[model samples]
Target: MFISVVIPTYNRKPILEKCLKALEKQEFNDDIIRNYEVVLVDDGSTDGTLEWLEKNKEKFTHVSCFSQNHLGPAAARNLGVTKANGDIIIFIDSDLVVTETFLQCHADALIKGEKKLGSDRLFTYGAVINTCNFDDPTSEPYKITDFSAAYFATGNVAIARKWLEKAGLFDTRFQLYGWEDLELGVRLKQLDLKLIKCPEAVGYHWHPPFNLGQIPNLIDKEIQRGRMGVLFYEKHPTFEVRLMIQMTLLHRILWGILSLGGILNERTLAPILQWLINQGKPQLALEIARIFLNWYNVQGVYSAYRDMVKN
Candidate 1:
């Protein structure tokens, strides 16, 4: 069987190098995975990503790069899926550097799962360990915060091409920062797709260490995520979707209280965050920053919801 590792990239050329390098080192049995390709879709990256990849084409033997306009991951991923030649499609982010056993683990899990379930009606989900260690992301161990119960996140998931086409791929309406993959998950669930957990397959998700300088961009992403969350709920207007989008009073009250009614904003917490960073606890600082970040999300969700109602 052949596999296609589909990755959508924006302006993330630095870690994309590591990601492609790691993918080139994958080892697997010929029978399990006869061949594999990396379908990398460059979503209008301004950082010369496509040019660099082209220049280093000889280095990334398995990589096939494509370019598109500044559309979101949903569109980029759809283009990748539509153009992929492999029957099995594994979705991962551009910043994710995976283990050598990543493809083999997914293949093994898929084979066993299909046999046990008596059908090819399932997809394999792998573990994603988040880290700030740019030099060596995989060196970081799994933490409680890294545990994800998401049904169909794209961080590390492998599925048959047929099911994704049937489910209509990703909704391009999700052109914002979040909820695109999960929205596709809702559609895949409607098609009765099963989730097979593959713990053996791991991917190290790389992100820069948190600092006070990043607060603005992080906050903007949270707000954008909030806007996209409402779009997700609109597509699937169910209680579960509402909960996922944080359109509930519980979320509102929780974030509000934790943020002290928006008083503990980035401005107010900048000193403490910088101090923690100086103390070499940027992760903790990020956690504390989440207090206000989540508040911005809740407010953005409600504001977008209100605007939707008005329109």
Candidate 2:
């Protein structure tokens, strides 16, 4: 089947370069795979991504670029799907770099899954190896932190285009940080769609090493995720949704205890975190910082939920 890889990016030109380059080197032919296209939707990037793509279009022969205003990824992805020409759509982040055999592995798995299931009511989720090594992301081994049990994440997944249309795509209201994809997964699950793991289709998800300078941004993201979590629960309103958003008493008590009721916060933990960074263990420092980061998330969720109830 033909495939359209949809990527929604915002100010991620450096990594996007590696992503597109990897796609351009896919080891698939037009016979079994039929055809494949990379549909890149730039979500109003100020990093001159559009101009760079235009000048370097010859490097990516299979790429088709589009642009939108500063709408969130949900909107940008909707535009990508609307413009895609392939029946099968692959969703990936701009920061992910894949192997040359990535598409072939997904295609083989999809074909096998369709044959085994007697229908095309399944999506293939690939393995994502997280790495802080930008120069050689693909060389990084899989770590425990990279393990994800998510049913459907946009990091590296392939599905029938019709299923996404049936699920009505992502809700634009989740424009803050997270849960937009999982909310759509809820609808897709209702439609009896299955997720098939395709371990061979590996993608290396790249991010810079954790540092003290990134603490503020990471905290802000957790807060945004918390607010968006409330929106997710509002749409689904199921026990599963509550657990996913961490709106339940279990999460509240857990984070509260871990953070010592907000006493062990950024201010209190700054010295320790900085010491870890100085010791060349930024990853460990980030992990330790999660104690307060998650506490902020729990607090933010409850605060937003309370505001919603008040209104």
Q: Which one is best on lDDT? A: 1
Per-residue lDDT, model 2, residue 128, is: 98
Q: Which numbered prediction scores highest in TM-score against the true structure? A: 1
Question: Candidate 2: which pairs clash?
Answer: none
Prediction-by-prediction clash tally: 0, 0
Across 42-143, the per-residue lDDT of candidate 1 in tens digits comes to 999999998899899999998999999999999999999988999999999999999998999999999999999999999999999999999989999999
Cα lDDT tens digits, model 2, 51-72, are 9999999999999999999889
Q: Give the local distance difference test score of model 2.
A: 0.93
Candidate 1: C-alpha lDDT: 0.94
User: Model-by-model lDDT, in order?
Assistant: 0.94, 0.93
- Cα RMSD of all models vs. native, in order, equals 0.9, 1.1
